[model samples]
Target: MLRKFSSLILIILFFTTNLFAQEKPEVQIGGALRFNYNLSSWKEGQKTRGGDFGYDVFRVNAKAKYKGVKLNAEYRLYSEGFGGGMLKQGWVGYDFSPENNLQIGLTQVPFGITQYNSHNWFFGINYYVGLEDDHDMGIKYTHNDENWMYAIAFFKNAEELRFGSASDVSDSRYSYDVSSSADGLYRNKEVNQVNLKVARKFASGNSKHMLGVSAQYGGLYNLDTEKTGDSYAIAAHYELNAGNFNLKVQATKYKMNPENPADQDSEGLAMTAYGAPYLVASEATTYTIGPAYSVPVEWGPISNLQFYNDFGYMNKANDMYEDSFMNTTGVLVTAGNVYTYVDLAQGKDHPWVGPAWTNGLAAGTPDAEWETRFNINIGYYF
Candidate 1:
């Protein structure tokens, strides 16, 4: 499958370049390779550390505009075990007016913050709940002007394009199983999802502010268990940029309701958390705040640097489950198109926030109190 996909992409690129060479359509190719060295401290047992070097992403992006019609496509190559080559985004659209257009393809869902609302590479807790940086097979209509921006999309399948087997019982990491047999309510398998977002921008002196609201609702059905799942989220976000300093904040309330709650294990509802096993929670509310300061310095091979901090907190409705929170402080150094990150992170009960030792810990484990990690990541973009 990977070989076939790679061949297809090469063919597309070949045809696009040769066929449109005379037209002089815009074409750009770029990607990034990231290396990580990580150290962890666990609350119990032994501490662990490791290092990995690989290409984080290799993508080909092409865009062309002729007359009033526009076409865009992006293909990404994933390393072993993740998947092979896949279509990250591909769309064709036409501009009816200056401020309005329509696009159809496998694209990003209009929910939460579009470009990610976190300073850290791992993002915030909302990402685990399918509210961050999620893409779907859908058609979207967008309108943008000086003051207001609006988007609405209808998705047929949340994440069905990746490598996976059609069988429900397939345990392959890339399988299409919507819900885990051990837990219910935490999944991105919802179909026919309707997502919408609207935002307004305001400028004040040297500061620019953007405030937005987003909502999503979807339905899920498990053919194996003959059960159903319903998911929805309501969120508000605010961003402010003043001089070299910027601040971003978001709050979200979400719910996942299962038709046959009895099928769930003793842990109750399963919620997705980065780097951590499925979190057990009925309903959840989460908030994230990030502030960053950037400074431009003249130095050989270094153009700018940024210092930032990200804080996130999550509260679960179930009393049996304790609250979770994460804090990350990092410095991002940019030299030309390359970026380096030096970070120290600490948290409890969440995967990316905590040490590596706590990953895959069963629910209600006493040793899952707190963990810490220090990481250095170097990435070069082309």
Candidate 2:
């Protein structure tokens, strides 16, 4: 399947290039390279430190605009092993007006804050809960004006295009078993997802304020167990930019309801946040807040510096289980075309945020109380 997809991508690229060559469409190319070094400590009486140097991501983005129609695509290569290479985004859109447009193909879902401002590469807890950078194969319509912006999208699958064997049910009771093999696509059968968001921006003196509401709903059928499940979330977000300081806050409530509770454990859906396990609970409420201050400076090989902190907390409906939370503090330093991030992160009862990250706990196991990590990331964009 992957080979076929690769071939299809090549075909599209070849045809599009040839077709656009005659029209002399505007073309632009850009990419980024990043590296990471990390050290970690676990609450389970384990300490580990390791550093590896490689391409965190090597992306090639191509865009062409002819008349009111535009085509944009990005292909990425990762050192972390993401099936050798993957399509990060590929979409075509038409501008009906300056404020309205329609996009189709694989694109980011319109939900939550579009871009997260985290000094740490891991971002906030929302990323772990499928509220951050979640892409899907879908069509979306968007409208934007001076003060108001709105978007709605419909997705055939929530994450990837699954075209393989049925999922394994051995751990179905503990978490979502979307595919039988790890290499297979991670998605549910007969799934449909809808995402919508509306925002209003207001300017007050030197500060800009944005308030938004977002919602997502999805229904899936488990091919392996012949069972069905549904999930939904409602969120509100606010952002304020004053002078050189910026702040953002968001709260979301999500619920995963299964056809048969006995068929699944407390952990509702098995999701990933940047390749890390982010299990959505049966019912949970999460909150995230970030504040940042930027300082302009001129020094040797340094242009600017920003200090920021991100905090997140997730409270489960079942108090019997511990709450999940994370705190990250870091600084972003910019030098010419290169950027650097230094971060210190700590978390409790959160798998992805911890050093010993795991998909989900065993059916009867409990999460560790605490974990810590320090990370440094360097990236260059061109």
Candidate 3:
């Protein structure tokens, strides 16, 4: 940890020295810290129970600008959020034109329709977004100006980097009887992605309304076995300040591959099972919608605070939407309205114990729907 901190300082120093080397030092640094507590209620049998806790998130961003050229770097220091972590984001980008730019290094893939949000609308729905824990160490090109934006990129599969040799395609495995080993350190599975996004905003009266659409495609390039996934999201959000009323709405649709037989094994199978046969295709789709309300505080110690509430409903089109898995301790965490637990596997309806790290559970079923999660959070930011 000490080494990491020292290295980070050195990197910042190097950038600062070089940044001031130029005359147009448009350097800017800013970030936010938010701590929130959530009270969860779950539905099981005929009883309803609740859970509570808190998490802190600290984020920072540093940027430098020179005319049309801009460079950005961001990091997040977190304490027990979705999964506890000091993990952060590090990327370097350059804007060659107002409509186009290229970024390389470590960054999120554009496969999932939902963007990692920066606001406090936490008490809503969770969308299936993200390429597992895979962060590509490659390049991404994006073109956007007004109403339309498109992105394409190739990534070094994070799994392959940790296990496989850079020169060869090695097969690795995780979980029982599960022939598909897409979750290994050196998973040689070929992964690639392409995405397109369109958005527009309109101003009327005293409010602003925005609409957005997102689409993504992903699959392996070399593996003979068939395993692929994709997502599509459409959302509309509006803001109107009438005295003290604020309102917004968000919705999404996620289409994923159907669950495969190889994905689930009732018999306790040992690890190291690999190179299993799989069907060519399957499909699962989910839809979710919700709204948000906020009122700015105008009194006492809460003068600068904003009170907000958000709610959503998710409809599963098939078995692909239910989360049926156990905690690390072999305790079954069934599907439906469970709070305090985040269904980490957004790819399948089956449950895989979350980052909380329980015993007795394996990772990522061959083909599972991302579990559905709804959470509410109250917080204050300055």
Candidate 4:
């Protein structure tokens, strides 16, 4: 299947470029192929079965630029059962100048951290709550200089997979978001969101640092009430690099209020991802810290190794809910276009960490014990 698709794409590209009558912009196509191995503490049966190893993802990325206009897009294919395939991102942008730019379409939201808030495959608790590495249908403006970087965006909402489906729940995309499901766990939809992020980049001797603050607010449109509620989050973050060592820290507070119908609960939300939905506390405070060091290596086929430990914690504003925690100790090996990550990840009250697929981010189960997963992911990028 893949070979046929690749050949067809190449054949089309060959003809499309030749058919152009005028000078063309630069176009680049690239992608990555990856696989993963996993063993979990919670899955006693899996241990008896010698763990699971399988295909991960094959993705394509495309970029082009013509004068001041640019485009970027990515599409991904995964294994048969889980998160089969989706459009990760697609955006069009115009560079007003070297220091200013604008983007429209499905682009990353300008909130919390710019690209990522975690160094591991399993991201921080904030990610489960829809604050990190999130993309939406929006327009954004950005400014950058030697000492300052700033961006603001107005998102209509998360990218919709279906326009008029009878069911509102959808987990067919890349990022996690709160929406109503067939189970009727939630009824609020994200809409009219705005985000602001500002940062200062500076250096002190051999150390480089970045300090930033981010905030976002939006309407939570209730499907049942036909009335709009609201949600908001504020965050502060800092990063430091001294020689080969790096440090990252972030703190965030968020709240959600939905005009839920009388029968529904307003203190909780259902966040969807990976073809499933789970509950999350509507109000919480989250914190994450990560530190990493690099070691240059002369080993065969290996250029460098990065050792890191990341820790994240979430404290729910509702006293009835349990706190959530996650920690990852990992090493990344980089060899040219090949990269590998070996991680020992532990979590308490995390949905991904357990065998039961419980909604740990919301009310949480009683006596929630820690669960662990040993994971290795290898990818080759071109």
Candidate 5:
């Protein structure tokens, strides 16, 4: 499959260049270096030590255009604790017209929200569960116009850095992908996924609105059983932009039914991203709400400030599984060639929030307490 896909790209490029190579290709290169400081309420020792401040990541972005053909790629390097360097996204596309285009390679999945579902740097709960801003190696077709937008995609699986059936699954990915658990109890891989997304745009006075729905269906291949099962997600979302205020509202429901051995628990499956692995609930309903407002200001290098509050809630279908929640209130500061995110985020049954280790996203500990983290991420972009 990989070889065939590669060949297809070459063939298209060759034919297109021969048919329309009248203009020179244009190229651009840029990137960023970022660092973070965090003080967590759950990390008592770290608080005693005056919080943790460290290098976050450095990334490079490259893009090129040759008539209707376009390419964009980004490579990132993170501290070893996060994950080693890896490709965030790389894709080749052709613009059929102003309203239509097709992309192939590692690209973002057209899911619940188009670009991002959260206003803060720390995305909503959906991201951790593989429902938001998730990308895979696939082909996607998109159409856009004044009144509507639509997209459909088919992905063979997540990035093929390593075979999923192997005992060790790669966690150096931008988004969560189904994989083996640390204990190796649940081992499943995503396959044959299909996604459909549509949105309607309208405006009235100073307000603009986008209302959309998304559906996704995919197969889950369990290594222990060597049989394929299925998973599906459906969502309804709305976005509003009025003057300097923006709001996002979404409701999503998802489920996974994977074929597993008798000894393994079928209630949940393992998934990983960012150098870590954990269990995800087999069935759940999620909701997200966010509101943001931007104010223009001129203070030294600062030009604007955006204040936002994003919230997410996950309700597990099984009573034995505890629900999960996350909320972030913050401001984004934009300066000349620099951006910073100042946020106070709180979570219940969330791994990143901490008191409980890897169990926050799965069955969840009954004694889980709400935890908070105050963070600031600064980046220089060029």
Candidate 6:
């Protein structure tokens, strides 16, 4: 199946460039192919069998541009059945300039900075990007300049990712059927919800400094029966580079419903904040920092070797009651290398992960709170 898709995309690109190059502004085609695997090590007491090995996400994206109009299609295959076998993302966009662009179709909700980070596997230090994945079908707009950038989106509340299927309320005791029409697409079955996001970027080349700030809000409806919670968050990240050494810092403050509320006593969908991190117990906030260094390698087929150690501490704060929220923290050590090829580059990154330490933190599940996680992948982005 993967081979077939790749071949089809190549064939389309070949014909479109040769036959329609004059008619079209340009059709540039490129994407990344990533194969990710996780190594899960049991904690002091916890034992789980299914959370180990195999590819987590296998995705391919293809894009075409003609004049100011652009088309994009992405397909993702997963090893686990957590989110189904295969999913597709297709969208159309119009680029007004290098700083202004707008796209509408079935794309992800722009709610998290980490979620937007490249999925090249070798790009970041953390094993996991965030608490939840924020993706949905929507129309998105983007603007980028020197010091400011923003994204505005409007999504269909009916086909929301959090509430995948309304007809088959498997998790909920209540049963409801989804409408089979376009009107159902925009209609918020329970509570009407929308998202608003804005961000700014600051950089100083002389000092090799980069910084960003972002905030967003996501509202939910039918808080009782649906039990869907709303969320808001603000986050910031900064990076500094000097010679071969690098330093980075990141922090986020988010508020949302608890993952497991004692009073609620029900299983409901969670609302993710601006950083795409799950909000719980009225709210959950976290902060993280790390430093890394890279050294040019003279070994076989390796360009540079890099390593970093980072730690994250997350907990519930404010409006504290007898809620089922707890503080979770993780320590990580990641190392990887870069390999350059004729027309592509590949790299592998993995982290020695520690368990989520929750002792003396708060009230919540404490099932063997520790485990080792591995994330390694080979990717080619053109």
- The candidate that achieves the highest TM-score relative to the unseen native structure: 5
Local distance difference test scores for all models: 0.67, 0.70, 0.38, 0.87, 0.91, 0.44
List, residue by residue over 1-382, the lDDT tens digit for candidate 2. Answer: 9999999999999999887666557888888888877666753332322543445767788888886689888877764443345676788999999999999987877877776634457788777655766666789999989899899999876444434455332221111222222332233332588989999999989999889999989875665455667878899998898999989899989876655335445354445323333344557888899999999999988988999999998888875656788899999999999999988888887665564344322111265656777778899988
Best candidate according to lDDT: 5
TM-score of each predicted structure versus truth: 0.79, 0.82, 0.52, 0.92, 0.94, 0.60
Residue pairs of candidate 5 with colliding backbone atoms: none
- Per-residue alpha-carbon lDDT of model 6 for 346-382, expressed as tens digits? 1111112333222122232334243344444444454
Candidate ranking under TM-score, highest first, comes to 5, 4, 2, 1, 6, 3
lDDT assessment of candidate 3: 0.38
In candidate 2, where is summed lDDT lowest over 10 consecutive residues? 169-178
* TM-score, candidate number 1: 0.79
Which pairs in model 6 have colliding backbones? Answer: 191-221, 257-280, 257-281, 258-281, 355-370
Per-residue lDDT, model 4, residue 311, is 96
Better of 4 and 6 by lDDT: 4
Better of 3 and 6 by lDDT: 6
RMSD for all candidates, in order, please: 9.7, 9.8, 13.2, 9.4, 7.1, 12.5
Q: Taking the tens digit of each residue's C-alpha lDDT, what string does model 1 give over 335-354?
A: 99889988888777765556
Angstrom error at residue 43, model 3? 12
| Candidate 4 structure, TM-score to reference | 0.92
Query: What pairs collide in candidate 4?
Result: none
Error of 1 at 142 (Å): 1.7
Name the runs in model 2 displaced over 4 angstroms: 1-23, 43-54, 80-83, 117-119, 165-190, 260-263, 273-278, 359-367
Stretch of 10 with least lDDT, candidate 4: 164-173
Sort the candidates on lDDT, descending order. Answer: 5, 4, 2, 1, 6, 3
* lDDT tens digits by residue: candidate 4, 316-377: 99899888898999999999999999999999989887753546898887788999999999
Q: Model 6, residue 196: what's the lDDT?
A: 52
